[model samples]
Target: MAQLIRTPKQLGVVIRNAHARSGLTQQALADLVGTGQKTVSRIENGHDGTRMDTLFAIIAALDMDLQLGPRSKGGKDISEIF
Candidate 1:
């Protein structure tokens, strides 16, 4: 699924929702991602800047895929042009 997360708040919502949907507690997900509960909380609350590797680990733990692409131009829909 392609999601347009333009801010930290949006990203936090996505992460929190994914974690909840995966039925994992903050601490549990943190453990799986080799981080601490506080870190997870911070990320979920959009407070701290999470490392890319840590973000990927969290995504993996939640069984989600993260893709990067350019934003749309001229009001066009964002699409993966790569």
Candidate 2:
């Protein structure tokens, strides 16, 4: 499922939800991410200081893909205009 994330907090919610869906505890996810549980907690809570590498690792751990595309405007995909 592609989620449109516009803010760090929104991203955090997505990650937290994905983590729950994967049935992994925070500590377990932390272990998989090679980070501390506290770090995972901070991430889940939308800490904006997270490093890109760590964020990517967490996304990978949850089997989630990060994608970049043209931003939709007025709830319409820009690609649709062409």
Estimate every model's Cα lDDT from 0 to 1.
Answer: 0.82, 0.89
- Best candidate according to lDDT: 2
lDDT of 1 by residue, 1-82 (tens): 6687766667788999998888889999999989999988888888757898988888889888888777656564453221
- lDDT of predicted model 1: 0.82
**After superposition on all CA atoms, how large is the RMSD of candidate 2?**
4.6
Q: After superposition, how far is residue 53 of candidate 1 from its true place, in Å?
A: 1.2
Per-residue error for 31 in candidate 2, Å, reads 0.6
lDDT of 2 by residue, 1-82 (tens): 8987877788899999999999999999999989999988998888889989999999999998999998666647654343
TM-score of each: 0.81, 0.86
Q: What clash pairs does model 2 have?
A: none
